[model samples]
Target chain A: MGASGKRPGGRSARVRDAVRQATLGELAEHGYAGLTVERVAERSGVHKTTVYRRWGSVEGLISDALELARDEPWPIPDTGTIQGDLRGIVQLVRSGFADPELGPVSSAFVAAAVQSPEAARALHEFFVARHDQSAEVVRRAIARGDLPDVVDVREVIRVAVAPVYYRLFVAHEPVTEQDADRAADAALAAARAGVL
Target chain B: MGASGKRPGGRSARVRDAVRQATLGELAEHGYAGLTVERVAERSGVHKTTVYRRWGSVEGLISDALELARDEPWPIPDTGTIQGDLRGIVQLVRSGFADPELGPVSSAFVAAAVQSPEAARALHEFFVARHDQSAEVVRRAIARGDLPDVVDVREVIRVAVAPVYYRLFVAHEPVTEQDADRAADAALAAARAGVL
Candidate 1:
């Protein structure tokens, strides 16, 4: 199975996959600042001209790689209660950040996003998609009258994840499962008070 | 005046100030990835050997620059009420991020923190100090019975600032005063509910 759990594709598709994987490897090892098309081409065993012609620049390659990284469908939980749903989502995010392969790649993307406009746009699109995908939980809570209609659904999700990111990127602290639990619970508390 | 608002040192302090200011200017224009010791030396009118001997490496220079950036004492709000104190702090942070001079310099530091371990350590120390400086607000709230005794004071402060940082770095959104108000209110609601 390929990245999407589907059968492998033709030669061109295979080449694209190889290049994307190589791009991620470069990002993990050297970060976005150190990534180069020539290095990616060498690592992927693709011609430099082909890599340059296809991706155009390092930003273009990074954008494509980010899309590929988030290609898998996100699992949105329906645990009957907003607290449970939030806990589930936060746990998933925490685990993703803790993954050795995904952690560095995600960090590199975030670092790149802060420095480059192209990366910023890509990161924004990725998060917006993820937020939209998980909007169902908030909708369900509203239907169940657990939260007021005035509450901002996206704000709740943002609140639930903000502390995790804060600890990871800003404080450079360890984010444990307890921290994830606290994040979910804190958001839930604020939402219940109708502040979110 | 020196960094602490008291002029004590002579030529050495002046040179340090000039070099640190030049480092920040370089970081603001070229970002951490693009910053070079040679450029900093030329910009500061210091010899390359002096720059090298003083800081040793790019990371060392950035670390020193970060220290100088945070050398002054932070203004801790004492607005009597926890809500008032939080609002003051968050508003101060929002304006700092929006300031033309400090804005890009701070973004550069955050970007450098994500990419370099030394920068990350400097960034973490800066925040830890800020958090400690503001701890009195939460302590006052607890004393007044505004929040539960078991509430984690540091967690509340972290929650208050997490949203601002989230919008600034992760979501790549414009952080407004209204957003700052909401962040303070949300953290207050959570603290009131004893989740923080």
Candidate 2:
């Protein structure tokens, strides 16, 4: 944008970013139920017809937002040890949902997915990307001779994070920092035991 | 009815039972979004006014259904060993979701709870009861010297069941029976490692 200076392609990308930001804002404030294309158009300053034509619907907006989120590089910890790395990953998950600004938006995604099959598929893909990225830590552990070469790296990531999700989403329970660390530790122990 | 001689209290109980059954049936077929007092009343053959008077809203109906479900006894397996017992419990959790009829109804509760705080509280209480009941097996394991007596029994139960729930509700991944067994085994491993 700085180099191109208002070219047609730059304008298109600006419009998409505007719409995605507005979508996250709306989801954060009003949740999936309160999101409307008209409101998003107003908030984003994109023309109503353009939003309608491009996004098609609220689900489309959510899916696009999720897709963009998935593409962003995550800060997977390179803490020099698998235990620290795993704990860092799980702690990041816990804190993400505890953030005042970010928590509602993340929860909004989960809330939306449960109600819509299309949204659920989008979320599934999002997790697929996330799991793949986060699995690198376990690979590092294997390379360092800390874990067996045959460990299911992705499964380790899942087990490490699953309890946090379960407590927050399924059981509606509060997740402390200790809870998150324990979850990571448990997954590591399981991996060490060859149970994962 | 015969034993109670159609007393007013007995009739009221019957009405409640019918409404509860209808609520479950509606939730199974159409999920939380499709549930309505009118539909529940019509399905139960109770007056619409009565349903509204008692249930108040869809969330209220959901809470009541969850309460009733909580009171129902779960088949807590006593397989004479913690390994088999933990496996049985996780398998039960996995299969309950995989069951054609029960799955949707159960999922509806989770769906509704995410959207409504009242339903979330009810779901929370429901899990409290379930955790208490399911923790008995862990206690038995401690008694039989199968586990350390000081272990956090409820945490073990939580960790065991969490991955299954995470696969289904959070990541939208398919949880195989082997996955269930592995989750249980992981929890056991964590417990033995004194991490839980």
Candidate 3:
């Protein structure tokens, strides 16, 4: 497993990973309110001062943990077609609904984002980065003339991914692969019609 | 000025409305966690016994307060065409974003909904009722041959409204009338093509 660069040796990397894992575990159990710097230090077998020095605050630790977990997922796929590319992105969105642990943690983060400016910025950055990755595929499709150059790729990306998040967080509907297919198809249709 | 049927034109009706108003004011001032039934009773001119007798718990009081303020705008207009109908719906969605007082109260309820099963159910029912109102407009369009009869109006309604809530609650995006128009257009196109 990949670990931080701040801690140099293999053993140091393992210690950092342990601390990050404990941070996320505490987050899942206690939410934004109950997660404490002291509790994380105790759980990770690291000194309290060391954890505080490395992370600065609970929000910083939470952000890094999310990044580490998120980076393990598959990269945006380039399938040489807009439909295939969108399908890939939808698959990633659907995966969140399938995982119980990730689902609740993500929900808590969303709630926290509403209240905390730092968390809000982090959440926005995370979505913008993910959308940028998927938008690259649409950019390629435009270059190949499969999609119109005038299409707003960001809007197209939003249309494709927003529904999946809506089903998971708002409606609590089953985010099936079929729902993914429908979302992709509608997004492609909207793009072709110059709505995107 | 609409009062509940439970206590009509009696001293009890005046006390109920006073308590409801005070509850909403407290929610605006302190949010859900900080709000208390005793505070509500003190803020209103009602006795603690009356407040306790009417609403058994804090959750019950919150639900009743929200219900008292519940006024979902009418659905898309009967313009004899989907274009005009969608324009009406989008306008309503836009107005919600402009409401400063309503915004925070609505968000607090959404956050509270995560913990209370009854609140979640009430939220679902509120949305379902809104969806049914919007769906009726789409259904009429199908009857008028502006849209296909095979279209699923329920799904189309979801596509139109979900983005508004997603932007409001999750993304914190300003949901302008233009955004609503685009969403309505996209959903209408999908429905016309029998995609939904």
Clashing pairs in 2: none
lDDT (10s digit) by residue, model 3, range A1-196: 4555655687777778988888778867777667788999999999999888988787777776756754554578788788898888888778764667766676667766665556666677676666676799899999998998998887788777777766655555667898887877777787787776
Top candidate when judged by TM-score against the true structure: 2
Task: Assess every candidate by TM-score.
Answer: 0.91, 0.96, 0.83
Error of 1 at B150 (Å): 1.9
**Candidate that beats the other on TM-score, 1 or 3, i.e. the better one:** 1
Q: Rank the candidates by lDDT, best first.
A: 2, 1, 3
Docking quality of model 3: it rates as acceptable
Docking class of 2: high
For candidate 3 chain A, the 10 contiguous residues with the lowest summed lDDT are A65-74
Clashing pairs in 3: none
Kindly give the stretch of ten consecutive residues in candidate 2 chain A with the minimal lDDT sum. Answer: A1-10
Which ranking of candidates, highest DockQ first? 2, 1, 3
Could you give the DockQ of candidate 2? 0.84
lDDT top scorer: 2
